[model samples]
Target: MKVDLFDFDLPQELIALRPVSPRDSARMLVACGDEPFADKSVSDLPSLLQPGDVLVFNDTRVIPAQLDGRRGEAKIGATLHKRIDLRRWQAFVRNAKRLKIGNVVEFPAQVRALAETRHEDGSFTLKFEGEEPVELLLERAGRMPLPPYIAGKRPTDERDKSDYQTIFAREDGAVAAPTAALHFTPQLLEALSERGVQRETLTLHVGAGTFLPVKADDTDDHQMHAEWGRIEPETADRLNAARRNGNRVIAVGTTSLRLLESAADEDGIIQPFADDTSIFITPGHRFRAVDGLMTNFHLPKSTLMMLVSALMGRERMQEAYAHAIAQKYRFYSYGDSSLLIP
Candidate 1:
C-alpha cells in the first residue's frame, strides 16, 4: 500500500502535551467491524474483556536518554538510541559533523563520555567514563527524550519524569514508552485480576526509530528498524492455551503486538522467542497472532498507523481517524488511546 493512504488531517491543538491527572482517566475509543466507535475511559478496560482472555503487555521502561555535551569547543547534543553494553552505547549525535573517532565529549559536570567510533548510519558508539552506570549518568546529565513534536515546544520538565513512564515499567531499556500500556494503572490491573482476566509480560525495548518518519512513498520500500524483544516459554504456553480455549490474545500496545506477531509461526502458533525483530506490518499482511489491540493514537503516514490500517480496513480506519479528529481526540505519544478488534 502507499504510505499516503493512511494519512489524515490532525489539528495541532489535539496533540496532547501531558497525560491527564490519573493515568487511566484518558479517553479511549473502541472499534469493531461495522460498528460505531465507543468512547470510553482507559479504566473501563477490565470490564470490557472476557474472563478467559489473555492480555500481553510490554514491560520495557523508558530511559532518560537525551544528553548534551561538548566535542572540543563545538557543543554537541546526543540521544542514546540503544544501549550496547554497561559502558558503551549507540547514539544519534546532533553536531555529528564536528565529531570524529577518539573525540571525547564531556557530559554534564557529574558525568563524562567519549565518541569511540562512528557507524555508517550517522550513529556513534559512545563510551562513558564516569563513576556511575550509564543509566545513572543519564539520570544526572540527560533529560527525558520526548518525541520531537512535543519536545520542540516546551523543555523536558519534572512532569515528564513521571508522566512519560508507564506504571508497570520494570525492565529498563526502552528509549520510548509502550504508550498504550501507559494508560494502565495498578488499580486497573487489580480490577482485571479480580475479573479473572490473566495478563502476561514481554519485553520490547522500543527504539528511537519509532519516531522516524516513513520517507518512502510505497510501504514496501520502507525498511523497518530492529528492536530487541523477548517472550518467555511460560507466557508462550499460556498464550497458545488461550488460543485453544477460544480466548482472545489481546496485545496491550503495538510493540507487544509486533513482538507477538514476530514470535508466531505460519500455523498461528506462538512460541518462546528472544531476538531482534524488523517485521513491518503493512496492509495485506496476514496476522498470525494478536486477536485485539490497545494502542495510542498514531502519527499520520507512520508505520504504526499503517499497522492499524492493516488490522482494520484502510477505509474504516480512515473514517475512525476522522471521527477522532472531529471529536478533538488527542494524538501521538502523549495522546489518548484506542482499542481495536478486527
Candidate 2:
C-alpha cells in the first residue's frame, strides 16, 4: 500500500512535551473490535481488561544514549542504536560529513570514542575508549535519547532521567523508552494485581529507529531496523498456558507486540527467542501471538502507524485517529495512549 494512505494531519500543539503527573493520569483511547471508540484514562485500564488476560511489558531500560561531542572544530551528535559488543555501539550520528573512520570524537567528562566504521545507511560504529564499562561512560557524558519530536521542542533535563524511564526498567540497553509503558505506576500496578490482570515482562531494546519516518513511497519498500529482544522459555510456556486456558495475551506496547509476533509460530504458540527482530508489521499481516495492544499515538506515515493499522483495519485506525485528534488527546512519545483490541 502507498505510504500516503497512512498519512494524517496532526496539529503541532498536540505533541506532548512532558508526561502527566502521577503517570497514570494520561488519557487513553479504547478501540475494541467493532465497538465505538471510548475516551478513557490510563488508570482505568484494569476495568478495561479481563481477569485472566496477561499484559506483556517491555522491561528494557532506556540508556542515556544521546551524546554531544566534537572532532576537531566540528560538532558531532550521536544516539546509540544498538550494542555491537561490550565497548562498541552502532549509532546514528549527526555531522557525519566531518567524521571519518579512525577519528576520535571527544565527549564531555573525557569520554571519547573512535569512529571505527560507517554503515551504508549513514550510522557509525563507535568504540568507546576506556577500560571502564560503557554504561558508566554514558552516565557521565550522555543524555536521555528523547524522540526528536519532543526534543526539538525543548531540551532534555534532569526530570527526563526518571520521566523517560518506566517502573519496570531494569535490563538497560534501549535508546528509546517503550512510551506506552510510561503510563504505568506502582499504584496502577497494585490496582491491576487486585483486578487479577496478570503481567509479564520481556526485553526489547527500542532503538532510535522507532523515531525514523517512513521514507518509502510504498510499504513494501520500507525496511525496519533490527532491535535486540529476548523471551525466556519459562515466560513463553506460561504465556502459552494462558492462551490454552482461554486467556488473552495483550502486548503492552508495540515493542512487546513485535517481539511476541517474532517468537510465535504458525500455530500462534510463542517460542523462546533471543535475537534481533526487524519485523515490519503492515496491513494484511496475520497476528499470531498477541490478542491486543496498548501503545502511544504514533507519527503520521510512521511504521508504528502501519503496525497499529494492521492490528485494527486501516480504515478503523484512521477513524480512531480522527477521534483521538478531535478529542484533544496528546500525541507522540510523552503523549497519551490507546488500547487496541481486534
Candidate 3:
C-alpha cells in the first residue's frame, strides 16, 4: 500500500510536551471494532475490559542512552538504539559525517568509544573502551533518550527520568520507552487487580527507530530496525492457556504485541523466545497473538500508525484518529492514550 494512505495532518499544539501530573490522568480514545469512538480517561482502563482478559506489558527499562561527545573539533551527539554486547552498541549519530571507522569520540565523564562500523541505515557501531559494563558507564555519562518530538520542543529534565519510564520497567536496555505503558501507575494497577485482570511481562528494548518516519513511498520499501526481546516459557504457557480458555490477551503496547507475535507459531501458539525481532506490521497482516491493544497516539506516516491500522481497519483508524484530533486529545510519546479492539 502507498505510505501516503496512512498520512494525517496533526496540529503542533496537540503534541504533549510533558505527561499529565498523574500519569493515569491522560485522556484515552477507545476505538473498538464497529463501535463509535469513545473518549475516556486512562484511569478508566480497568472498566473497559472483562475480568479474565490478560494484559501483557513490556518490562524493558529505558537507559540513559543519549550521549554528547566530541570527535576532535567536531561536536557529536549519539543516541544508542540497541545493545550488541556488553561493550558495543548500535547508535544513530548526529554529525556522523565527521566521524570515521576508527575515531574515538570523547564523551563527558571520561567515557570514550571507538566508532567501528557504519550501517546502511546511517547508524554506527560504537565499541566502548573499558572493563566496566556499558550499563554502568551510561548511568554516569548518558542522558535519557527522549523522542525527538518532545526532546526538540523542550529540554528533558529530572522529571522525565521517571516520567519516560513505566512502572513495569525492570530489564535495562531500551533507548525508547514503550509509551503505552507510561499511563500505568500503582493505583491503576490496584484497580486492574481489583477488576481481576491478570498481568504478564515480556521484554522488548524499544529502539529509536520507532520515531522514524516512513520515507518509503510504499510500505514494502520500509526496513524496520531489529530490537531485542524475550519471552519466558512460564509466561508463554500462561498466555496460551488464557487464550485456550477463551480469555482475551490484551497487549499493553506495540512492543509487547510485536514480541508476542514474534514468539507465536503459525497456529498462534506462543513459544519461549529470546532474540532480535524486526517485525514490520502493516495493513493486511494477520494478527495471531493479541485480541486488543493499548497504545499512545503515533506520528503521521509512521510504522506505528501502520501497525494500528493493521490491527483495526485502515478506514476505521483514520476515522478514530480524526475523532482524536477533533477532540483535541494529546499526541505522541508523552501524549494521551488509545484502546483499540478489533
Candidate 4:
C-alpha cells in the first residue's frame, strides 16, 4: 500500500502536549466491527476486558538518551540513540557536519566520547571514556530524548521524568515509551489482578524511529530501524494457553504487539525470542499472536498508523481517526488511546 493511504489531518489543538493529570482519565475509543466508536475513560478498561483475557505489556523503560557535549573546541550535541555495549553507543550527533571520525567529545563532568565511525544517516558509533556503565553515564550526563515536535531545550524537566514512562516499567532499555501502557496505574493493575485478568510481560526497546516520519511515498521502500526485543518462554506458554482456551491475548501497545507478532508462527504457535527485529508491519500482514490491541493515537503517514490499519481495515481505521478528530481526542506520544478489537 502507498504510505499516503495512512495519512489523515489532525488539528494542532488535538496534539497533546501534556498528559491528563490522572493518566487513566484519558479517553479511550473502542471500535469493534461496525459498532459506533464508544467514548470511555481508560479507567473503564477493566470492565471492557474479560475475566480470562491475557494482557501483555512491554516492560522496557525509556532512558535519558539525549546529551549535550563538545567535540574538542567545537560545540556539539547528541542523542544516545541506542546501546551497542557497556561503553559504546549509536548516537545522532547535532552539528555533525563538521565532525571527523577521530574527533573526541567531552560530556559533562569527567565523561568523554570519541566518534569511532559514521553511518550514512549521519549517526555515529561513539566510544565512551568512563568506568561508569552506559546507563549510569546517561543518567548523569543525558536528558530525556523527547520527540523533536515537543519543542524543548537540552535538558528535560521533572515532569517528563515521570510522564514519559509507564508505571510498570522495570527493565531499562527503550528510547521511546510503549504509550498504551502509560495509562495503567498501580490501582488499575490491582483491579485487573482482583478481576482475574492475567498479565504478562515482553521487552521491546522502542527506538527513536518511532518518531521518525515516513519519508517514503511507497510504503514498501521504507527501511525500518532494528530494535532489541525479547519474549520469554514463560510468557509464550501463558499466551499459547490462553489462545487454546479461547481467551484473547490483548497487547498493550504497538511495540508489544509487534514483538508478539514477530515471535508468532504461521501455525499460531508462540515462541521466545531475543534478537533485533526490523519488522515493518503494514496492511495485508496476517496477525497470529494478538486478538486485540490497546494503543495511543498515532501520527499521520506513520508506520504505527499503518500497523493499526493492518488490524482494522484501512477504510475503517480512517473513519475511526475522523471520529477521534471530531471528538477533540489527543494525538501522539502523550495522547488519548483506543482499543481496536479484531
State every prediction's TM-score relative to the real structure: 0.97, 0.99, 0.99, 0.97
Cα lDDT tens digits, model 4, 188-292, are 888888878999999999888788889999998899988889999988998999999999999999999999989999999999999998898998999999999
Candidate 3: the clashing residue pairs are none
Ordered by lDDT, highest first, the candidates read 2, 3, 1, 4
Q: Each candidate's lDDT (Cα)?
A: 0.89, 0.96, 0.94, 0.88
Tens-digit lDDT string for candidate 1 (178-222): 989888888889999999899989999998889989999998899
Model 2 segments beyond 4 Å from truth? none
Q: Which pairs clash inside model 1?
A: none
TM-score of 2: 0.99
Pairs in clash, predicted candidate 4: none
RMSD of each: 1.3, 0.6, 0.7, 1.4
> Relative to the unseen true structure, what is the C-alpha lDDT of residue 71 in candidate 1, on a scale of 0 to 100?
78
For candidate 3, write residues 177-240 as lDDT tens digits. Answer: 9999999999999999999999999999999888887888999988999999999999999999
- Judged by TM-score relative to the true structure, which candidate is superior, 3 or 4? 3
